[model samples]
Target: MSLAQRWREARPPVAGVHLDSGACSRQSLAAIDAAVQHARHEGEVGAYVAAEAAAPALDAGRAAVGALTGLAGSDVVFTTGANHALDLLLTAWPGERTIACLPGEFGPNLAIMAGNGFAVRPLPVDDAGRLDVEGAARSLAADRPALVHLTPLASHRGLVQPLAAMSEVCADLDLPLVVDAAQALGHMDCATAPAAIFGASRKWIAGPRGVGFLAVRPDLAQRLQPRLPPPQWPTALSVLQRLEHGEANIAARLGFSVALGEHLAAGPALVRERLAEVGRMTRTAVADLPGWRVVEPVDEPSAITTLVPTGGADPETVRKRLIADHGIVTTYAGVERAPFEMTSPVLRVTPHVDATDEDVARFVDALAAVSA
Candidate 1:
């Protein structure tokens, strides 16, 4: 049996063909059970004491994330999720308010920047929703903005941005790059840290919700003046400590550690390989669906495949029918949610590591029926 096949055996059983991995993955039973067990322990020992015992697991999780992102344990700080992590960074950041990001940047991220009083400038992208590297480079040469934020992969689309190429441009101009790898964290290679990298555990990590981390290049982290609620507890000795508030979620961290352990066991390279294969397979399977435009490029690499309906197929209605009638799951991406380059709604279809060729075929059949 394949690695993903074996991994599937250990996870909680799914109600149906689950293809919304881009939102949250069906977690492993061990991951869930570890959380439950930790909660029980907390009840017996009290939250503070239980947290002390969980320190090792917390450290393990940090190490796992660090290894995955090519950072040291000290460089990582846990947060509630990606949005909160971004808020933390923005709160601490004293850089110039003007920032440059791709046209297809995640809507929530854009909101965070705006709420924090940053002037967001949109960079150009190609037809496939990828960052135009040369264009962006040219713009950077002209503006030399205080920060350049990039989402390595789009939440609503299947395209992977040219992160490395953009990084090189930023590096040359001494421009600070902040990458939101919420979609790419566990599924992509993030070892080479730029200024900061932040993501959630729920998506590709297959970890529990309510948990995520922000990894900073240690040297760069020193520049941050982390925020603390008024009457701040003064024990925070480091950047992560200052950002993290009292009473860590011991159970969630334990669960996240188990999930991280599962990822480590499977090996990052192998997991990414399997995910990319399933991505291409699903894209090919639904390529022939009529009256639909494949928004994601055929050659662009990502586990997400978004299909935009045309000729009377309402994207929202299709999404409802996909789940209600077929027991298949998908996320409907409205233009408002994407807001930058998307003009029409799209359906995000994500195939997982264990998803087989048969799974994609069945999903496509049901999708076709719904669209018709």
Candidate 2:
């Protein structure tokens, strides 16, 4: 089937939810269809064929991600998803490598770093979700970390971190910086420094799921021997050898490549401008709600806007209400705080290029009804 036909068939029938590419226009669908055709002709039919032809798609996808981050194609590595890319990075750099990350980072990334046996350190952030740059610098210098993982924007709260300045710090310290751009890829301009950059196409890029890219500086890439050694080694090491192979998601890769082309054609500035407008409208409509708080900064980095209810209101309650009653879908950040500690639950509302003013207004109305 054509990509357009697939998209039309896959698109959920809903009005107010700000999830799933926010607003998929005709241009986007056409681009995806073209990519689908390209993938078919390229012999990307099944897993075995995909594995054999992985390098080309990997190369192409890397170039696209590099353009987004202002890096060279040689610096990029295509991965199955952001999580898998991160796992590869962490596994390759395991053992007492002091790693510093933002406290309010995306939960899964944090868990992966911890699970991989790195000594994880948290950088302090203000209530506004802005990282203390000086504090981060101090922590990095003191710890002399091998890797510094940061999210340009907090996914849960939609606050923009000072990436340019942070990149400068990493450069000065000669530390490798890995940015989780999963949520910021199309919405913001990422630092082009020789740091390792990771992002997924599923979020803002409006691509199929299970496709992401990782960019490691040429120098760093050379140093990274895969966590698993080569196959055909001794029997004792065969299980470990499998880790060396990088798996590619062929269909999703093609979809992501197509989505990226569409995004580039539209231009990042235009996408950001449209999303910002939707965000502003959403904020304005919900600003007067008595107990609801906008967690995103007044001038946040990207198109994601998060809201939280005061007085310990349950986030799931609001999320379920929005999905069930109004057909609006939103996300909540899960917490893992100690007992007796008060953790703020958050509801995320991400605006996509396809989203319209009507969609934003409907979401606002839904929030008002649920909060009331």
Candidate 3:
């Protein structure tokens, strides 16, 4: 079957046009069923026994994360969501509480770092808010913050960060790099190695909500050491496993495992290619709408396209009208999503690989009417 056909068959159905994959994609029916089955099994066999039974699937999920993120499953730690994963890493971070990141870093991440007692500093970036690689390397070498945090793809815009080059720089300088791949994974190539990479299952992966992960390099895992003792006697769990909380939603995790399996079966490379095409289609179609400007370049390799409404039209109002009147879903990106870079709110549309030309056209028609 064609990829689109398979994607359509995998999910049940939606009420209306969904153009906010950047916020959350539609979960496959298999993923939903896996979670339901696990929940039922927990009630039948008791939670602990059911969890023990799910070991293999959980391991495979970690392996899939490793395969996609260029780390080992042994170093992967599952958390509630991307925010939780970042908390685990930041709270456990050693040395001086200072970190460097791009100006357009995810806003909540800045809050997390600040709450963890880290002082925020900006890395060098060009006019478009993309990292200036050579300048960034020099800045890192000179300033030498405790570590570097990077959001390869921000929620407010579609510009892809230069992670591979930054990763090389961090490697050469022996600096620890923390990557927020919540928007990058599943939507684009995310195979670069960093000190740690964390993301959610809900976004591009179309996994269940409340499931996220953190994958640390084995060496970094060893360095972080144990904050709390393991629940079991004799401590047989790996370092990363010890970092995981004792209690978690087994059903959601099982669902995430199923989602990971689906993603792998669909093929990550093809999935990315399809998303790029969807991005182009969405951008080209929406750019033609009157009084709304597409923020990202037409060919930017991201599924997300930020739309800035001209003539002072409120993005929040337009977003609400699109949903309430037109039955089309999209998200509004405010300055709070990327405080340093975004001056005002912009509408964000991110259609997944399953999206069709009709979907784009529906959004275009709805947006033009709402804005008019």
Candidate 4:
């Protein structure tokens, strides 16, 4: 059986047509079971004792994340989630307070920067909301922001920022770059690292919520100073170990490890191809819907597609109707979710590898019916 079919069998049946993987994916059976089992173990063994025994599983989780992101096992440490990870990275950075990012940066991430007193500068973006790599390079060189941040796959839009080129620019200028891969993790061959790629496991990895990872370069990690001191391993001492301290959700980490293993077994490249195909099919299905506009370019990056209504029909309303009436799921993309104002309100439609052509067609038909 195909990986998608297998995954679907392992996961809970979709409540409706689940096209909201961009928001959060349903966890697989193995992940769910692992979590439940760990929780049970903790209940029996006592939390701290169970946690201490979970060392192998935790190490294995780190190794799994390393395999996915092309980092050493020592480079990754589980965090509460992407927001926590981002906050930790930013808090620890003892550099200039100027951070360069696209105007369409994730809302919470932008808030974290501003909250932490960083001068968040905007890097130019094209009409499609993609980063202007040349301008960014120039800005980085001329202004020398404390660091560069990119969300390879942004939350509110379908545009995939040019990471390879941006990374190249950062490399040439010897600048530090951090990637928020919350939406890109399981969809892409995230093998490019040395840049901190932090994300939640629930989004694309199909892992349980409350767990995410921060995989950073050794030098950058070395410079990091976690706000909270290590609650558990006060003496273990490496930057990652220090970061990994404090009581953690052992169950969630084990579940995340299983989710990562599932991805590795299928291979990242194959998963990317399957998801992109489904995305293109979905885009094509809805491209000609009268009065609706597709926001992504012809050549899209990830599996996310955003559609906007030309009429005054609210995207949020349509999203609700899709789920309530037609059993079709989608996400409303509002300006508030972005750092800057969105030109047009949109609905984010993201499908996973398990989605079939029939599923895409069903979603488009549902969309048209609801919009009508």
Instruction: Provide TM-scores for the models.
Output: 0.96, 0.83, 0.97, 0.95
In the order shown, the candidates' Cα RMSDs to the true structure are 1.7, 5.2, 1.8, 2.1
Give me the displacement of residue 297 in model 1, in angstroms. Answer: 2.3
Candidate 2 lDDT over residue span 125-199, tens digit each: 766657888888887788687788888865566667888888888888998889988877877778456468887
TM-score of candidate 1 versus the correct structure, residues matched by position: 0.96
Q: Is candidate 1 or candidate 2 better by TM-score?
A: 1
- Write the residue-wise lDDT of candidate 4 on 1-372 in tens digits: 987888799888888789998888889988899999889988998988888888898888889888877788889999989999988888877767889888888899999998888998899887767788988888889989878898888888777677778888998998888988898888776667747889999988889889999999897877777655643545557777767778788899999988988888888888888887777787888888886888776557578998878866789999999989988888998887784857667889988889988888888888778888
Error of 1 at 68 (Å): 1.6
Model 2 residue 133 distance off true place after TM-score fit, in angstroms? 1.6
The segments of candidate 3 whose C-alpha lies over 4 angstroms from its true place after superposition are 230-238
Best by TM-score: 3
lDDT of each: 0.84, 0.68, 0.89, 0.84
What tens-digit string does per-residue lDDT give for candidate 1 at 1-372?
797787789887777789998999988999999999989988998888888888888999988888887778778888989999899998888777888998888899999999999898888887766788999999889987788999988888877777778888888898888989889987777776678888998999899999998888876788888766542665536777778766567788788888989999988899888888888888888888897877766756678988988767887898889889988888888887679777888889987798987778888888889887
Instruction: Write out the backbone clash pairs for model 3.
Output: none
Which digits, one per residue and each the tens of the lDDT, describe model 3 over residues 284-328?
Answer: 998777788888889988888899988678999999999999889
Better of 2 and 3 by TM-score: 3
Per-residue error (Å), model 3, residue 27: 0.5
Ranking by TM-score: 3, 1, 4, 2
Clashes of 1: 0
lDDT for 227 (candidate 1) = 65
